[model samples]
Target: MAALMIQGCGSDVGKSVLVAGLCRLFANQGLSVRPFKPQNMSNNAAVTVDGGEIGRAQALQAIACRTPASVDMNPVLLKPQSDVGAQLVVRGKMAGTWQARGYQERKAALLDVVLESFRALQAQSDLVIVEGAGSPAETNLRAGDIANMGFARAAQVPVVLVGDIDRGHVIAALVGAHAVLEPADRDMIAGFLINKFRGDPSLFDDGRAEIAARTGWADLGMAPWLAAARRLPAEDAVVLDRAGPGRARRVRIVAPMFPRIANFDDFDPLRAEPQVDFGFVPPGSPLPGDADLVILPGTKATLADLAFLRAQGWDIDLAAHVRRGGRVLGVCGGFQMLGRAISDPEGVEGPAGAAPGLGLLDVETVLTGDKVLRPTTGRLVSGAAFAGYEIHVGRTLGPDLQRPLLICDDGAGEGAVSADGRIAGAYVHGLFDRAEARAALLAQLGAASDGLDQHARVDAALDEIAAVLQQSFDIPRLAAIAGLEQRP
Candidate 1:
């Protein structure tokens, strides 16, 4: 099997999307392709067929390859709970939580684990497209780094550096990386990719040549700013701050942006709705007074974020929104925060303590060591069929559950509904993925549904992006670099 690693000049340089597009391109050629990331640090995750979780991006890549996602795809996942620490997941299971410095010290030991997963994928596929985490220029972390250069050299995988030209200074970013990387690390980069270029492709010929001349790395190709990217769910949280088009719409839906927000992908379908205007209200900002619906998004640490919500006076705004007859839906961790209280005696998330919740629903949650990871399908209480997944680490129970929001396929009730039916919550993420469910919920607000099929849209987008990559980059050269054509 042959493999090629895509490392970025920095995070958000379209590394994940590139790997995914490459996977699809090869798969179209009838090659058995697989994707692997040595390490990932994102709260936006996808439950795997193996009953574990990996970065949602990897799961998307697996879908592009037409394969079921496996834990071997992403062996090391760091889920941040706060600025200084994170809960570390290894091989699709929680290992433990560690501070930043502490993790740095411990990560060296994980190289073995990372390589094992990489070898596992390599054994099963004709081609394995590997993705690196963040930039390697942060060389101080280079000593024990398993995410970038360290993993690259260990696996003996040739690298193609990706630079985001849209961020400007494309010349410097590429040349600068060449300057900063150690000789050994620098040697691994066989070529460089210029991403998100706009306007005439010929305009950057000189620029690409300059980079190639200076760095002695081949110019793999320049990819234009792709429209298909918007259709995919972003793994980075920064996308939440993007300003809307200011277009008029029939309904406005807003969600408070929590510091530790998890699974923000849950909102992508709603954001795509034609009649809905959706946005994330940043911390310290008031929940839109005119909103038809306010969402409390899932977070990594429910108690901590719940406290932050109160500190931001969102508790008061939520009260006002409820008073204004606005509808509210809490999801997963957010659902826990909507209950009467949250208890974490084992400190599964943070300090062993209890805190009062927004009390929108008559329920309570207790943090536990066990995390639930399962894909579920059922019908909403509104009688609309829905399909989604569950990924969480708490158990909730109370009176509001008596008026359960939906019944599962096994006839067990899931989620809770308040007495007025204006407030609802569930541990299930992606509850709005199903068009019928989204339609049913929007209908309650007197809005019309556009009947969007998310799966089809995403698949079409993958096709579009793969086509773009095929035309933009020299596939034969890339394949030769990976020795893909040489051997097979």
Candidate 2:
């Protein structure tokens, strides 16, 4: 079994996308490839075939590899619930919640579990591409880190360091990592790759040489800015603030950027609609009065983000929007927030308490320790078939559920729609992934659909990126570094 680990200089350095592209590239070459992450901290999660949860990025990588996603792909998953605490999932099961300090000490014990999962994948696949979280330059956290060099050494996997040139200081970031890392950790990095380069790659030849000379690491090659990447789902929330394509169409859709937004990729399909103008209203910006649809996205911390929504005066704006006969849709935590009340008696997220919801739906929710993770397929009230997943930690009950928005194949109702049909909330994510469902939803807003299947679009984007990597990356050198025989 052969393995190659990709470690970035910092967060949002495109490590996930790079690993995903490589997975597709290798799989396209007829090699069995699998993606693994020792640890991942993200609210964007995907439900696995085994009824477990893993990072959404890993799910996408699994698609690239033409395999079903499993919990073994990402053994340790962290979903931040607050500034200092997060819900921990070990091997696809909820372990418990841990504070920032508490997790630091406990993570060392998880190294064995991480390696166990890695070995399992190694045994099954011809090659496994592992992704590292954050950066190893964080020497303070380096003592018990299972996310980076710690896992590299434990798994005996050779690493390729990635530096984002678009963020500038690629030289410092690459060479600086080598300087701060321990000698053994430095030895684990087999080479370095430069990512997100904009202008001429020849201009950075000297800069790349400087990094090679300074760190004594092989130069893997530079990747130009990939336009196809935007078509793929982003794992980090940092990209939410980046400007999207120009809003040329008439249908206006706005969603507030919550503090701890989770599964925001649910809107990727909406963003792809050329006739729909979708925007994520940032902090300090009021929800657009002309918006035809206002969507409240999922959040890791429902109560905290609810408070944040109110603090930003979004509640009042939402009321105004509703008063103007605009439409409102909420998913997961957002669905809980739109209810009459949200009670947290066990303090699963934070302090034990309850908060008044928007009261748009006659529903009441109580946050519980037991999480719900499942993949569902059903049709909307309009009979438009859709497939989605549910990942939440609360139970919602109310009268409005009688007018459910979706009726699953199992004969279970899944969401609530107001009497007037202007307000709706669902515990399901990826509600609009289906072309038919998306068309139905847009029909309510006087918009049209191109009948695009989101999953197919993502699959095409992966192939496009793999083609780009075929030209931009040093595949032969990378194979040598990973100790794999190069295929014709």
Candidate 3:
């Protein structure tokens, strides 16, 4: 099989972004490239066109590769509900919930599913770039591990170990990984690349040779950090908590830091605008008193995160914000949280039966029956067309719906808007991804807008990263080094 595995020395080392860049890079070379992440753990997920949920990172990578997203791209997904338990998604469908021990014990039985997805991708693509999750040195977890080295070995794919130079200890981290790996696992490492290097590349000359000598792995190249990385849609679930200035404008939107935040990309377009600045306020931090608008992003566990929000005193803060005539918006779970009460009689999100919302709107939600999953297109009160998708399980209705913000084309629930014009919400996940929608919001806040072309902007950003890689990275050397036989 013509596949290459991108394994990392550790987690949070930009392996996902690197894989995305490589996917775009390879696709530009006239090769059909597909991104594969053997296993993923994140609350941030994307609905596949085929109706399965996959990690947001894999979804973004698929977009970068210019390929249609599929469950086959990410075979295993884990959405953590508690510290020790996670909801397992196998082959794009909800498998079940499992604690740590239970999951490992049962993980091996799912290898066939993983293999099936991998083989499918291999058959469809000229080149498939598989991304490993976490570090490969977790020997204790190796037996049932379908990610990292186990996946590489199972696919019989050569691996390029990527270490983050920006994290410091580059030398030790790279060599330490080699030292910890079993002899057979170490043999799969065809080469090593230093990623996110900031300073002079030549200064790391000695470190590169040292790593090669110690690990018996060839030095592929050192990649400098590309500033355009921020322009790409972040797949990492952690981006839900990423704090940054939004578009430079008079109107500001502050989003509460929900405990189990998901689909935070709903706000990316706003942040990309120079006219608006978006800030994520955590539990202890005070909300932005100057923000003209406040937003409640989506979450995995509405009841749990809502309880955590109450504990943080944000409920009081949100009330005060709305009292002062600040515009408040909610999406999906956020939409649920804006109502009078959220009833989880079935206990889908948490053990708690129900929780009170901020009550800015007169709406109340009942978490019951069936989930709503469908692509949507609708119009604002002004007749402007907007498009997004829905993935929620709750049903909400209130007097506020007398003036709906978005009128659903389908027979689904029309989203709500408060009479005083202080509160609004929709079940749609990406309402702001559209430039015109963002511009309209900015105009409502009396702020300047950029009118950006989101699709072109993302494509240009990927192209810029490819240009950076071409200039700084040693692609030919990397390909050759990645072909090396692993040391015994």
The whole-model lDDT of each prediction reads 0.91, 0.93, 0.81
Question: Which residue runs of candidate 2 sit more than 4 Å off their true CA positions?
Answer: 244-246
lDDT of 2 by residue, 1-488 (tens): 88999999999999999999999999999999999999999999999999999999999999999999999999999999888999999988899889999999889999999999999999999999999999888888898889999999988999999999998899999989999999999999999999999988899999999999999999989899988889998888989989664476869998999989999999999999988999899999999888999999999999999999999999999999999999999999999999999999999887889999999999999999999999989999999999999999999999999999999999999999999999999999998899999999999999999799999999999999999898988999999888889888
lDDT for 348 (candidate 3): 66
Candidates 1 and 3 compared by lDDT, better number: 1
Rank candidates, lDDT, best first. 2, 1, 3
What would the TM-scores of all predictions be?
0.98, 0.98, 0.94
RMSD of candidates 1 onward, in order: 1.3, 1.0, 3.2
TM-score, predicted candidate 1 vs. hidden true structure:
0.98
By summed lDDT, which 10 consecutive residues of candidate 1 come out lowest? Answer: 239-248
Candidate 3 C-alpha error for residue 388, in Å = 2.2
Off by over 4 Å in 1: 486-488
Of the two candidates 2 and 3, the one with more favorable TM-score, higher being better, is 2
Whole-model lDDT, model 3: 0.81
| Decoy 3 TM-score against native | 0.94
Q: Which ten residues in a row have the lowest lDDT in candidate 3?
A: 479-488
Number of the predicted model whose lDDT against the real structure is largest: 2
User: Worst ten-residue run, lDDT, model 2?
Assistant: 241-250
lDDT of model 1 at position 279:
86
